[model samples]
Target: MSQPEPGAVVDLLGVLAYAELTAFDRLAEDARLAPTLTGRAALARMAAAEIAHHVRLTDRLVELGADPAAAMAPFTSALDTFHESTRPSTWLEGLVKAYVGDGLAADFYREIAAFLPEPDRLLVLEVLDDTGHADFAVREVRAAIVADRRLAGRLALWGRRLVGEAISRSQAVIAEHDGLADLIITGTGDLAGVGRLIERITSAHTERMTTLGLNP
Candidate 1:
């Protein structure tokens, strides 16, 4: 496979960078949904990591001579739509969204990183949420379900809606940004490769839902 043009690489990096920034902000805001101080603190800490990632991405964008804001602008709407459409109604619902959403995102990034060159690949890997975050989310979801078995049904339904909204917004991003799609195809090298990437992400998401006692 050929290396992506420098401009395309910059665009891709910009998207990733901006994604981190928005994620940090969103997570911080969503932390208020937490039922306890501990849960709120955990989410806040996760948000802090996203801020660090945003800064790193911004620095890299500067090194590459691209405007970080401009690079991120194109993606704002789609991402905002996803977050808005799937805002969680309760503390347990929030945990499920974080768990399911971040799991799929991490899996997607892992597959996409395989197609990127050195530093970018390493950067993406570095920004992935550690197992601690996933475990925290899982524990919260499990405890909530155990407290009220009926919650399993509500949270599971909410999780499904969240996934659907996420997919819709993702497809919107793909449709709106040819450059983003190019990055994926160029990195992976074909439609089949893209499909495999999605398959892995979806499978991981399913497993995460099951682990939380939710029907995928």
Candidate 2:
């Protein structure tokens, strides 16, 4: 917290702003794959939540004297690559992606936010709030698996792939953005702190998978 704050806070907010906007778009597109009207509507609600978060972050960036669009621009390419590479081929896969991918990102960002000064840290946590969709995703996916037990194995594998892609993209982001890496390392107080943060994220993911009756 002793180091300069504006650049890191702005960068973090920018990344989050774009992430939320893209999440809204992705969830809306994925909704088309939903098997039922109720399921589609649920995804639609989650998409709305993402947009709300995006607006909050964008406004915060402006209040901090940053252009929302310009701040989000640097992360646009990398995040797009991440979504493109991890695009879901099936409705079930999309649910698993939404649940697992979003959870992982939230966990990681929350951990880093702990290192920020009071203002940015609080704003980041608030924006990263759960959309109350985890339970819905777990219930829907579990019901589908129960109806077709064979789907369990496929979805478990899909969850693992999402985790893998998330990790790869995160590593690339860190390598390409020294400020982001510094923000995380400094927030954690050291590299060991970063390791523990990642461990926490993985543990949380395992719990979510188990809740869904999927292998971690």
Candidate 3:
């Protein structure tokens, strides 16, 4: 478990900043594999959105008197390992990974944001906004499934595996960061609150899968 000490807002911002930067790189790379001009453009735009977020988070970290690189450094391994292990084998896998992974991450952050105070809370909410990518993923994945019914089973399994890996990696992250782990441990205050948080995340994930026409 991470050192159980009190943490600053920079800790959270740093984590988010690094995650955004990494997502930008990955999305940009995936853009090259797009099957059509529309997809390439969409992915490029997505990557750019991530760059905007990374910049915001990095600037905020500087304002908070935290070294952006230092703040983000500790998280590289956890995130990198997860990405490497779950690297998609197909374009649809990439989309599914982005959709399912981002949804769960946003849900988790939103829950954690409830425990933050003032401007940071509002900032987190605003930065983590969906930007309609999930909807695009749902439409694309659904259309593909319609074209090949066999894809439904494989994609459903992929969705499940992605979420499961996410859960595992998230727990590892929480365990390694006192700021995050302590927040979840103390802010939730009781097992019941923790349970509720998990339930909310799970329910939201179910809805997202259903929207993608996949079984949860």
Candidate 4:
């Protein structure tokens, strides 16, 4: 693969740093909706992990000579809009968002990282690692569905909505950030490659939904 464009790397890191920071914030807020102390604490740990990931991304941005705040600034509005639009009203919804919604974003980033130079690619992969939320979410959500089969229908719809919002916001982020767009296009080799990337992410999302006992 060709060397990743330095500007694109910075843009990718900047957006990822901002995304992690917001993930921490969203998770912490969602913790309040948890039905039990155990669930709340689990979410709190996940929030801490997100902040830690944010720090790593920011540190890498600084190493690349970009101000962390400046790099993250451009993404704040878009990311915030997404969270605000999709804010969960129930603990179960929060869990699904953490699992399915955030998982979708992670899958997209991981796909693009394949096009990056080794160092940045590895950093991206590392920061995107699950913070134990996947199993936690799947366990909790599946149990909830068992207790109230009706919930399966509701959450399935929620998952679908999250996918649409996520894909839309993702496209917006890429379009707004040319460096990020270039990285994905360059890495994928063409627009069709980008389509295949989306297909993979969507397929993964369906698998995650099924894992949660929800209809894809």
**What overall lDDT goes with each candidate model?**
0.79, 0.89, 0.84, 0.91
Predicted structure 4, TM vs. truth: 0.98
3 or 4: which has the higher TM-score? Answer: 4
Select the stronger candidate by lDDT from 1 and 2: 2
What's the distance in Å from true for residue 120, model 2? 1.6
**For residues 1-216, could you state the per-residue lDDT of candidate 1 as single tens digits?**
777667666766776787787778777887998878988998999889888888888888888788889888887887777778877777777778777886776676667666677787787788774635678888888987898899888888998898888788778777777766787887777889888888888888888899999998
Worst 10 residues of 3 by lDDT: 1-10
TM-score, per-candidate, Cα-based: 0.93, 0.96, 0.94, 0.98
lDDT of 2 by residue, 4-110 (tens): 46787888889999999999999999999988899899999999999999998999888999999999998899899989988999998898889999999999889
Which wins on lDDT, candidate 1 or candidate 3? 3
Q: Give the poorly placed runs of model 3, Cα more than 4 Å off.
A: 1-6
State the weakest 10-residue window (summed lDDT) of model 4: 1-10
Over the full model, what C-alpha lDDT does candidate 2 score relative to the true structure?
0.89
lDDT: worst 10-residue window of model 2 = 1-10
lDDT of 2 at 82: 88
**Candidate 4 per-residue lDDT over residues 133-194, each given as its tens digit:** 99999999989888989999999999999998988988898898888887888888898988
Backbone clash total, candidate 4: 0
Candidate 2 segments whose C-alpha is farther than 4 A from its true place: 1-4
- Model 3 gets an lDDT of 0.84
Q: Sort every candidate by lDDT, greatest first.
A: 4, 2, 3, 1
> Each prediction's Cα RMSD?
1.6, 1.1, 2.8, 0.9
